[model samples]
Target: MKRFALFALFVLVAAVLTSCGLYNSKMASDPADVETVAVVEDAATEQAEETAEPVVAATEEVVEEAKPAEPQIFEPGSFESPDRCKNCHRDIYNDWKESMHAHAWTEKWYQQDFMMAHHETDGATDLLCGACHAPIAARTGQLPPADGSMFDETAKRGISCDFCHTVTGLDQMYNMGHVSEPGNEKKGPRGDGRSLYHGVKFNENHTKADFCGSCHMVIHPANGTHIIDTWQDWKTNWYGEQNITCQDCHMTPTPGVQETPGRAALLGKWRDNMPYHGFVGASSYVQDAMGNKKQAEMAREYLKSAAEMKLAETVAGDGNLALTVEVHNVGAGHKIPTGTTYIRIMWLEVIVTDATGKVVYSSGLVDEKNHVDPDAVFFRVQFRDADGNLTGKSWRAQGIGYDRRIPAKGMDSETYQIALPAKGEYQVSTRLMYRSFTQATLDEAAERTGEEYPPVESVEMAAAQTRVVF
Candidate 1:
């Protein structure tokens, strides 16, 4: 009886184990209910847990892999090159190549001055000059070191094809603070193009005065001084009120308005008027250096048109001759001589001549030192040192105590009364002069190079003749 009972117990245990094994095998095949089956079969459960974790992780990874990645934002520094544009737009490229804008940073004089500044300050402010000269170098994270050794070959080419076209956005006005969006989409005065590489060009900001203001208006970084405020003067006056753009006055061959007709690009359609890239301004020295006599003449004409002078009256008053002179900022959208205030000069000159073509008196004459005659009333911005002393060296200035810039589309007047013991027929003349370098600067250059070059000064004169009775 005991043996029979034991045999039955063994049979029941075998049946239970066989049923669990079969259920786990079916669960393993489906893999869907493996966890539940494994609960009843502990050995199968351990095996399912081990294989299922890896399979589940792999499935998640496959789902993630099915989606695409987002496109990258355009970067200006990554511009391929402007040589690509020359493949189609050969004429425009040639015109740009011959332009002073192309050689701005590469020019010898500019490079010399740049190197001198680097040497003098020990690289403290080389980037300041490079801000305009080599904006590409500055934007490409190549500057601030000021040595120019770390800059790429493309960046060393000064304002090249890539630099201007890659300007996708601007940071500010006058100092040429631009944000580059480098690619085939060349930004210019126009908005129409069919090239797939070029993106949509729809920003009227490119067509306004503010675009030029980015570089034309400059401020002293350390002292918070207004070194060059051409844009500010224009924005505060009639030019701003009339909606006159810098392009309107500057981009044209004419001093005041636009009339050019051409296509902006080879693939692009022809337009009635396109922005002329010559960018002629008041830089006769650069124009002359580039051997562009026509551009130099145009620059001189522009300077002549920039201001108009008028002599209102010349009379004897209380044994003194009284003369009234008026100067109007007629042409420029900003103050005349706006960029690099240290080098830009504007002064009033008055000459009193007697009969027989003999000169009686002269004011505003630049002396051997290139200094303005002390007796003359000069109109200019003055910088001051830390100790409150006046400084002609812009780099040494820590403060600006005075500015007499003529407001855009505005007028400034000065009166001179001189006592004359003997009266004769006197011819009174007034002149507005603009110079890129001071006399002292030229002298220093002569000293360094051991070669003498003539001091360059361009003058605009307004005169009136009157007879004084003795």
Candidate 2:
């Protein structure tokens, strides 16, 4: 009986292997010999069935070939409006309504810059800039009329709830490569929650830095110059090495890492930390200009926490004072003034005052016309055009010409030599100031659009004061 069982098991194994095409794969290649092989296989099967009496029959399961994934197709206006999401996510909607993402497409400053690029490049930059600023419109093919005349009302909302939650995948790391899957199924960090209106599926990408990096990193398609490098800057920094993501900092209301306990939706399960939708950064100027006072205050808090300044001064017998100001990137996970460094400006302001309350020396002070001193020590970036001249216009960039930013946990120092007229307990005050844009940029925007913008004010990021006696 044991020998019979062994023989039956061997026959079953051979029959299974043959049925899987393992034995016939090589023989089937020759069409002329196919008939002979089929006849021999049929005779062998009949013989096996006749001899192996107790063997059970089986059939092979056919495997289908894998095809490439296609892009998610949706009709225009398929993405739901932010107002619809407001019903279940009131607090989040309120925060997002005034956030930069909400105004990304409608913001005047961005529009000014985008239209200028469009005119200069003859609409080459239209798709590039629109992909991030107006993603719904870009994906739905409503973007060619760059003025947004053809855009639906939902597309005008700009990076709203459905747009982000429906992101299925990404095509690349830069230039807004986010893939959209607009439907009833929503993807986010947590998928277990039950919703009456839609299906919630967990997406690991929603929690990773790459989700934000897709839009944050911008590379010029024409010359491959890195226009915005906030994503790469953080990826290579110490925070990134430790796996701290942008969502950890920017998604919170404050500067550093802190948890806010709440439910993501009004009817959803409780979460240890629900992401703050304000998305505040160094945008106090834009926030205040747009009348988002609360968001502007939050942005100022971010600037205040980003860095700290220390002053060191030496008084020479000849009345020559050498004051050194060191700015430390203590709070920000990436470089100070990380995104759009070309348009934004960070600089050192030194003011030496006499005991009599006289303003003896001042650098980096805004003039009557609201322009920062051109010769001030500025921490920013400038791109080099084809002619090698420095330009702030990102669309014209061929390469980086100048870059001086305080890296995460790094320090930058600048020394000022001032000859004291009569030094006696002179107070030296140093401040690290930041501005969203220069007065010159606003002036240019006003010139091109005939619309006046408010004066750009500098936010004091960090400050230090020291007294020197001679």
Candidate 3:
């Protein structure tokens, strides 16, 4: 009867264990834990040779049950500060610190734009815009107000280190499809690396254009308009079929090549290649105003590299000069000015001077109020509002008015007619110029901040000079 009671007691204990879920399902998913269990069991068997085998086996099984699985994820607020990443990767950290990605949320211009869009939409697009600009705050449910009232200290970091490395995968190409876990297991290009602070895993998505496209492509929530189609431009173009991702251009020593050799971490070992963290793009005006000189220069270099300008055709006849200036999109895979195209400005500035240094004609001059000349051939997306009036505010846009931006590997031959009034050997100079903010928008931004605002910065992207003999 005692033997029968022992068997019944053991059965009851097993039943209770099953009901209480003592065996974790997550353990099976963890290969490291499984390997640990196997090693422990084998070691226990080896020790059992000199002791009671049954007792040793039972203890080993209990030990295995008590061992916890490796953590794969963390709660939203558990992200490490961007400064923490600087402790090891100072170079990358410094580079990223000055980038627009780092300033995406914190930039005053973006904040003003967000507030304006939210106000225009009656708080409808608060989350839609914030999802990309302030992703951490948006993911944590602090972005509905879009006034940045609910954001925490960490969320204000914008696209900080932890938020990016924690991204496991992407779901789609639009509307914040980046799925991040926000934990110590930082996914990057390094897989064999073992860090003192966090687990390292290789995530190839970091090197893909699709990943960048996931956030870079923005669509309007109200009218279902493709507000930002930078990614689509690249994906459907020659570059995408060639497998040249966005990382190849924005993160490389030379745009479109992917072999940047350096150490990604402070491991005292060299990696085959390391991508730059500057995230360089065509944001010279904005980056300069943000007090990031190096990044501004980098952005300037990128813009300069994006286009090439030359006099495709020139005519000097009948006391008049007609020139066809060819502007080619040589470097960029998408349109010249891709994101926030309405607010951004890209135009052709042409000037004709006589041999005696007298200005005969000039186009694309900035007015006293910092506005570009209305007659300049500006490459920008135009929009119409609900009330059928032209508007630059994207949230109020009902339809596209016109898209004059140059496509990738495309050319825009602009014909300028100038009257050769007493001209002796007229010299023509043409440049493609770009600026992020216009005077009207900057005025509103200054009014909102109640501080001294930066003057409108118009960067010359490309230049061409030729002398037309009349």
Candidate 4:
């Protein structure tokens, strides 16, 4: 009877252990508390399995709540006109009124190129070019007519306040990657301001370099060639390393960082620095053509402050004049003439004269026909087409053929060798010149559009003189 009782106790213990193992296995199959309990039959193990179902459901609920929310997209006619914003933001609106952004879509020079590209590509480049130029039209599906006939009044305003302030996110780094969410919610760099008409939200992107980089960096969609590399160049240079953004320089009236202490809107809070919205660049010619004198002067100031010229001279006994001119990019954050370099140009103009003031040598002089010397050393970018021929047209670019622009905080030197006819303390003068658009570009535009444009004037960026005696 004693042996039978001991065997019965052992069998009962084995059955309890087997039951505990089964319960633990079931808990493991569920999504919760599998590792919290062991297979040994204990009070804690029983309690975990009893509460496992609720924990599993709660875990699933937490995961479902962690997913990101979908972005808000607005339809056509949702964005407000610039005139409506001017009621509150008078100063900012005035600054943007004469800016390149304001004339991006309406400018004659841009329309010429855009129309030509449209015709050549059979409307392929309509959306691509208009994405940044006429952003509202592209986003609203008012484009593809290759003209402004289908656009609304707000779409004709170009890069206006509502379009820029309503940007929600970016899909990429180049080719107008900005995503817009047009509504009563206005996004900006600051959020503490109170507005009766709309809700304000702080967008960190407005304070970052990536905001301006989206439109400035242009890439060819078909061939993957970089058409405009301003953003890319700035990103890889010392300015990007130092975290100096485009807004820091371009948004200010002059070059470098200058704070304008004021309110963004008339009813907004006063701040230590409110960004100037002129967006000044090396487009003084465009501004002048558009009859924007203030913006043109500011653009000229920016160009003048960008670089400095230095002269190094050596004269040999055989009357050989060897002059080296170093062009230093002093103020610009990226390369000199950063945007649309194919259509813009910067070159060195050197002139040497004797004591009698007779011209001995000259380079980069504008001819009677208003053209620079073909053999001049041009600091610009050019690309190669599919046939491997060099071309200045951005739409025909397949690969880079020539790229020689002065980098930020960098120096580029060119040495000229000229034989002196008679040397008696010869005076060497040099000027670093910049042109907004090449004469050839405007000539082509005139040929295509049947409109006459004034000759592009050269802006003197920097000058230096030294007396070389032999």
What digit string (tens of lDDT, one per residue) describes model 2 on residues 155-235?
998889999999877767777767788889999988899998999999999989999998897765444466787887788
Q: Give the CA lDDT, 0 to 100, for residue 46 in model 1.
A: 29
The digit string of per-residue lDDT tens for model 1 on 94-196 reads 6666566777777665665566545544554455557667766766557646667777777676777766665656654534556666665667666666676
Winner on lDDT between 3 and 4 is 4
Clashes of 2: 0
122: Cα error in model 4, Å: 0.4
TM-score of 3: 0.80
Model 4 over residues 160-237: C-alpha lDDT tens digits? Answer: 999999987776677777878788999999888888999899998899889998889776654446678788789889
Error of 1 at 404 (Å): 1.9
What lDDT would each prediction earn against the true structure? Answer: 0.58, 0.76, 0.68, 0.75
TM-score winner between candidates 2 and 3: 2
Quote the positional error of residue 105 for candidate 4 in Å. Answer: 0.4
TM-score of each: 0.75, 0.84, 0.80, 0.84
lDDT of 4: 0.75
